[model samples]
Target: MKKSDLALGIFLLSAIIFMIIPMPAALLDILLALNISIALIILLNALFSQEALNMSSFPSILLFTTLFRISLNISSTKLILTTGAPGNVVTTFGNFVGGGDLIVGIIVYIVLIIIQFIVINKGSERVAEVTARFTLDAMPGKQMAIDADLNTGAITDVQARERREKIQEESSFFGAMDGATKYVKGDATAGLVITFINFIGGIAIGMFRQGLGFNEALDRYTILTIGDGLVSQIPSLMISLATGILVTKVSKEADMGDILVKQLFSIPKVLYMVGAAMIFLGITTPLNVVVFSAYGLLFIISGRVIANRIEIAGIEEEVNTDESSADEIRRPENVTSLLQVDPIELEFGYGIIPLADTNQGGDLLDRVVMIRRQVALELGCVVPMIRLRDNIQLKPNQYVIKIKGTPVSEGEILFDHYMAMNPGYVEEEITGIPTFEPSFHLPAIWITESQRERAESLGYTVVDPPSIIATHLTEVIRNNLGELLTRQDVQNLINNVQESNSTLISELIPKLLGIGEVQKVLQNLLKEGISIRDLITILETLADFASTTRDTDVLTEYVRQSLKRAISNKYFPDSETTSVVTLDPKIEQEIMGSVKQTEQGTYLTLDPEKTQDIIHSVGEEVSKLENLGKNPIIITSPIVRMYFKKLTSDYYKDLIVISYNEIESDVELQSVGMVTA
Candidate 1:
């Protein structure tokens, strides 16, 4: 049988024995039995409330003991005193003159007190121990409850109470003590103290006699050495037992306070407050009172000492089963395969330190669990069981993209390593056109007039720079000066040439200018930070003497000659180089060439094959460009009628379209309507 069952049986048997005891002995035994029975009732209630105990006989046992003890204590004590049994027995047992009989009586009383103290203390410790075990078992559920409550911020006292109620409903009687286990383990000494106090109270209640005033009864009770002070303690002892039971059930544990209180409440009943009143009115037991009160006093001191030490119980090292599964899975003989550090900028400083001689892994498992939960919440998916040494697979659908092999700064090699690990991810790079190619290798012709003055005012200057002249042959070649060049194709050519040559600008600058235009050109070239020495070559070429320099309407034929000669001589020192060069010659050419002719009266010419294709292509392009502009137009060279084969239909088109000031009037080119073709 369990300890509690044994205790219950013992108490019940004692109650029965006291009920049937020879009358003189029955009185004191019965009172002691009642207190014992009450303690047993509390123990049985704690275990049975959850229906864990087959205590169908408990009610019968309890009622029987209560009746038997009450009837016997009153009847037996009456019979004993009336027959002078105690006095006769004491005298016969020892020599009172030398104090032998008194000493023997005292020893018997002391033994009784020791027995009572042990019973209460043992019961109290048992309750605490059982309750603590139940508490440890419920830890996971309790942890979940607290976490859920904290997360929702709705953890009010009412919610806590409700939680307790729910636990109580779901749990066995002992389970109610789960919450109290921690407190109880730390209060074992207090449980002892309470037990001692209750025993002392029992003795206090047992020592009283009946029929006297309060002080008079007390004096008589004081003379009763065996049960002195016991009668007065009955009520307190009962209260303590009841309180300890409720507390143990609800808290799932007991401490020294419980033992002390139980002792207080379970004292011999005749010295209870009612008994005290009875003592004043002439009814209590002197011998019972003396023994109970003396024991109560002894218990108080011992109970305090026990309370102080109970909290110090050694926690044995048991493998926490919850942690065992994780421990068993730790990758032994493993090396760190991947490490992901957040805010890679902190890799050099605030990153995780090496764990040797450190606390880094103290809560590593919890951290991993928390992170896994967070990741699940974020991704709206369940993650696989993560093993400490298992590699994180980078499947296409896996959201975590990469991991690092080593710590690194932001934008540093480790970051690059991280970026490289993901096969399909794109890295950032630069794509805009570089400036050197367009200026030096393309037929970057600038209009001298449109109205050339208007073109100049918008910061569009006719390029006459030395670098322009020197690169002229190369530009013509790049622009398809001798080959078919689509605009896009021309752009690609220039880009290719620039990419191929590191100093393309230096090679092209000195070839394109003449001395006659040098001063005006030099100013422009110098504005871009070019040297006068390079300009001197172009000036010297113009000195070969080709033209009059002062003409206003156009450059003297000689100036064009000097400039062209200089450009050709520099880019193509071998005559075969000049023969190989070409300028813009594609569909856009035919269109611009046609526009140059018919839009104005300028002298222009086109091959028959080119002219017709030009007209067709220009017509197609004009239709598209029309939609692109607010009041769209086909703009062409200003001085040549053949320059403009077409014009837009709107008057405001002139205001919006780009032009040159060399045109005498806006009428230099005019539009009829949408082209019929």
Candidate 2:
């Protein structure tokens, strides 16, 4: 065992030994003195320390010391009643405390008891209780503040973690102290009981066994008992004072002594007024002229000195401020920090600020947090922190969502109004300001609070401003998640999978595929609105086919076939036949015929006229499905699926294309249209 651990264990063990074993006078003296020293050390430490967390172990220390002190009390009581003389420390303490009179010593002990019990212990207990409760109550606000700082780029993840840990430590410290204060109070009570027992027991033993008269016994044992009581209570009093100082301390900065002095005496005006009052009292009243007038003169002089110092300090501060400002203007700009960009940003105007501010009862910031979580759960990827900024150039209630510092979408709202969109079944039109829904550009109307209930009753979809922004932001993130997936993110995903299936990641990465290659395949999946949360299955599929071809596109195709069950469930439900389109075999063969391969990858070199004709036919087929109110899905041979998706992506952003190999047999399908050129 380490030396410190062994020493602490032995220290605790000694407390038990003290209660069990008999001790000589010399050893008892040394132990009593040591106990006094321990109490003094605790008092001084608590008095000077800056933060309450600095004494986080104080609760455990309180328990240990209380047990030890009670043991010492037991020892001293034994010697006082049995031997009538514990040690010179006790004998000398008795004489000094009694002042050769038992009554005086008794009165002094009673006062000490009152001060330690009713004043210090009681007050400390209440303060610790209230402080612990307050700390617990304020914890959530503090955590939210930390998260705000993190989201705004004011602090990094590491710094946020440290701050959160500090908050936890503080709450725990105060809570433990709340319960620990009772130990100090109980110790005082125990001291009172032990002291009474010693005095009564000592008097009886002295009179009966030592053959002393009643008065003589009273004089000897009363003084001795009082001495023992004083010895124990003085240390307990110091400890009690320490507890009060620690729990009552409010600030976490600098020494307690420094804060107390500055806060109490730093105001020169108060000092000057007090000095004037002293002078007035000395001159006007019949008070002692020398004593009171001397005090007033001293205060006036001190005030003058302090005021002069303050003036000089203010002038120096002004000079320093001027110098700092000049230096700041002359220095070269630090633009490195400005070079970085947020992955996702929501910039809004001042009129919308109230929606993001907690004090204004706005839950926009909370919605943003939920958006990140929702995206993660739906897409199986952790979204980067969305930074919210306020832009002044925009109109009131206008906001924009940006990807990598470039605005991609913008919206405006009327305060205290809800957006109502017709779901094609709401025949009765509500009278309101016409606008387009920012998310999908569908026609919507802004309705006031009174119109909201009626609009909902009329089968119109009603949403508040925050919900609109949150939905729009969610769509933007879903669209851009492919571009936002970095190699580092891929590595993190690999590490997560490696925790369970190490061999698969090890064989796939840096062998048949690099991180960027895996990132591309994952991005490809994400770009098509596929949830990559089933990472193990995805990696296992890659591991199976990655060796034959390092081409991520080809590998992604194979992985898709492996996840065909999920894809089938997503697009075609077994309960009903899904309407879809099928590519003509002749055009599929023609597409394959034009395909050319190079060192880079495969590309189609079909005639532009032919490509245009095929695209037009596909668009006609897609419109037919749209007219039928069915999703535009086209099935092709497994070899031509990826190329067909690439060709149609520019024309249709939300179209879904699947291969015959990517569908399950149990899924019912009906071809309502065909694409041909």
Candidate 3:
């Protein structure tokens, strides 16, 4: 064990032995001195600590010290009753206080016990109880404040976590103090009882065994008992005061002395008024004018000094501001800095600042964090950090979501209103400003807070302003997920997966396929809104077929077929039948004949008129499916699925194109409509 740990163990063991073992007068004197020193040290430490959490171990220390003092009381009582002498420390205190009168000494000791037990100990216990209760009650609000700061970017994750831990420790410390105060009260009561026992027992033993008279025995034993009580109560009183100071302390970054000086003298006018009142009292009463006048003069001088310091600080701040302004004007700008761009940026108008500002109850930053986590779960890749900025040139309530420096989606919101969306069939009409929801372009209205219950009762989905923006941003990022998965992001994924499945990563990366090639395949899957979360399966599939052909599109199709069960569960979860629109047999054959292979990749070589007719036919089929309230999914032969998806993407971007091979055989496929040319 380390030297410090060994020493602490020895010290605690010695305290326990002090009660059982009898010590000489010299050793007893030294132990008494040590006890006083420890009490003083504890009090000083409490006074100097910056915050209550800094002294988190104080409760344990208080318990040990209380036990040690009680043990010393027992050892001294043994010596006083048996030998009529405790130690030099006790003798000196008794002679100093009694002055040949044991009655005075006993009364003084009783008063000290009363103060320690009734005043400091009891008051401290009450304060600690209330502080602990309030601390526990306020814990939830404090935790929420930390989360708000974290979401607003005012503090990082590590800082917020540390603050939360500190709050917890503080609450626990106060609770411990509440229980530790009982030890102090008990110790004081024990000291009083022990002193009475020593006085009565010592008198009887001295008179009967030592053959002393009654007066002589009473004088000798009473003085020794009072001395022991005084010696013990002094240290006990200091410890009780320390406990009170610690529990009553407020949480701040400044020590008690600094806080007192700063707050007590914060206003100099109060001091000046008090000084004026003192001078008037001295003149009216028959008191010594010089004494009161001297104090008045001192207060006046101190107030002036404080006032001058405040004025100087104000002047210095103003001077610094002016200097900073001049420095900014003289600084040169770099034009190249303007070329830098964020991966994703949200620009909002000035009036919408409250949506991102924590001070105004804005949770936009928190929403953005949740969106990032949600996207990572659904898409299997982390999105880039979103940069939020305010643009004065835009409309007050408008916000724009940008990807790669280009504005992709922009919408407006009313801060004080909620967007109530009609799910296409609502019986009741709630009056409000008519608008379309930005996320899905659904019919919605900006309704007041009072109308929220009515809108919901009418079967309309009600959303707040922050949720609207967060939902819109989520869709925009999901659509651009392919572009967001950079080469570095792919490498990161491989490294993370290698930690658990190292052999799989080693066989696939830089051997069967390069990171860039893997990135392309992942992008292809993402473009079709497929989650690459099952990356081990994707990488294993690539390792199997990548040696034969380097075509990313063809490799992606193979991965999809391998994930057929996952795909089936996503689209037709808990359903036995998958409804889809199919191309006519003749149309599928005609498109398959037009497919041409080249060195770069495969290409569709259909005539412009034929492609136009195919698109018109697909559109008609999609409309018919929508009218039936069915999701539009196109199923075709495995050979022409990619080509057909490309053709319909421009006009029907929301349509899901699947191949017959991608569906599991257990899932029944029902043809809702057919596209004919």
Candidate 4:
């Protein structure tokens, strides 16, 4: 479309003509030399052109050209050598090539020409795709931020992909090709340069044979080489030099060895043999062998040994460098200052946050914190003060001071009521009656004595700050609050909190928000504490959820929610009693037959039909919970019973439902139990 592209087209057509035409032998050689010359020029301009080089296309173009030419020359040379042509001519050029015979040459030429044309046609698009991929992979810590948004509901995959495409399109073209061409062109061109020089020398010999003396030679011609080795190599040498220089300059920050290695293989295998050609010629001439030997040594040093060293050094340097501020910003900071205490140490319980706006679950903490914050907002508390100070003391005995009620203070009642809701609380674990752990462990922070009294009167106690509170709080907040806060919610809650455009947290909001402490604990247990056998059980649970279910994501949520509740209470009663697992009649018979009874209960290996049927029912139960979305819905024995009863009831006559409850716990009905669906 542009002038440069048009020129390249013309050069390609000229090359096709040179390969295809049946011109006089001398004229054909001259045309081949000219064609090579023009190709070098076009390729150089393509490399340095203001018009961007689509690198993805460039390789195929180079490959097609190099292969096509070598095949053509070799085939044509063989034909000419085998024919009754002069032995001198056969020796000079090696053999016939291209269409070794007219018919073969035409077939080869047409096929090569078509392939070359197709490469050119598709080159631009290929470059675009490659550039796009490179931009994504090579971009720095920024990608993590991008991923955060992707995990959250902030950005869609299509949007992220589109942004990446746009960035690739805008980046500099030659900038991308720097390291690639260095080694490939290096070997190819070195051999080419030597050949061109030899051709020049050969042409001089030709002129001398025609009876021109030294003075006459100077007068007759300015550049005498027509078909010398030097002439042949000219194109390759220029291309190689261009590649090396561009690579060195543009990719200065890139590893030198990596660039060189890329170039080394890019040089054709035929080119190596061409370098060796000098040694063959040197058997007859003085300098031929010496020149080839030096060339080979140079290629070995620059293209292999030194290149590797440079790359290794560059990698080491990168390894030693400190992570940039951008990286730091992407990672969450453990801001465990006094005011922002760990929720875990606060004796606060975990709850799932719902993102009604998005399919992903939100952090329950953000909602709770938001409601608490509303108290602040409504009271015109422009700023809530939080401070961390060192080494403050409180009377340990005074922690259990009496509440100010007629019988029990309002503060004590609230504390008791809150503790009552916590299924994890065990009365035997407590030392004193009505003692509530002080949720906050603040030091002397210039608070009025009256403020302290008010806090204590509310049944709060002061104690030494817990060491693990920071990490614990961050985990709780991150798991509980991270998902529920939309950009709008964030903007409203905190005044001018800095935001990142490419945070992965913002991107995959739903998935991140959906994570719970139970899941985190399960992962840790599997990673560090669980036995291989128990690990297999966990994996089996995941696999069942994955293969039999429509969405593993939902099933995982359900399992996590159930696990969270169970672990918090230090009990798995729900899992023990009201399991969603339905034992087949055949499985029940097998278990009964085996009857390996323990003090607590019986255990038996399940059969194939039983396993399959259980797996099927589990999937159906999970599928029926499509209404729950990403959040796991808790199912109790009562709930399961009610569901079955409703299914058969006349109240839901129009709807189809199934009853399945062959499993029940041995524990009393009041004992909380878990059942992962």
Which number leads on lDDT? 2
lDDT, model 4: 0.37
Model 4: residues with Cα > 4 Å off, grouped in runs: 1-13, 20-53, 63-151, 160-227, 241-677
TM-score of each candidate structure, all chains considered together? 0.23, 0.59, 0.54, 0.26
Deviation from native of the Cα of residue 179 in model 2, angstroms: 34
- Tens digits of per-residue lDDT for model 2 on 260-279? 87787677888778878887
Candidate ranking (TM-score, best to worst) = 2, 3, 4, 1
Question: For model 3, how does the per-residue alpha-carbon lDDT over 408-492 read when each residue is reduced to its tens digit?
Answer: 9999999899999877788888899999999888888899999999999999899999999999999999999999889999999
**When superposed on Cα atoms, how far off is each prediction in RMSD?**
29.3, 11.2, 11.7, 23.8
The 10-residue segment of model 1 with minimum total lDDT is 413-422
* Candidate 2 displacement at residue 491 in angstroms: 2.1
1 or 3, greater by lDDT: 3
Worst 10 residues of 2 by lDDT: 328-337
lDDT of 3 at 555: 92
- Model 4, residue 361: what's the lDDT? 38
Q: How many backbone clashes does candidate 1 have?
A: 124
Candidate 4 C-alpha lDDT tens digits along 1-677: 99988977775665566455533456545545554765676456555433243333444445445543433343333223223231223233321332123344334434433433343323433444465456556665456667788889789999878756644543444334432343334334433443344334434643655555765443222122211222333344444443433322335334445555566654444445654664566556676677767776555444455546668877887865645545655566623332343212222211111211125533333433554454333222221221212111322211111111111111111211222111232232222234333322212222233344443444443222221223223323333332222344433322221243224333322333322322332333322112112222333344345445323233433343333432222232343332222323443344346444455433444455654554455345444443332212223332233222222233322121212221123432221222221
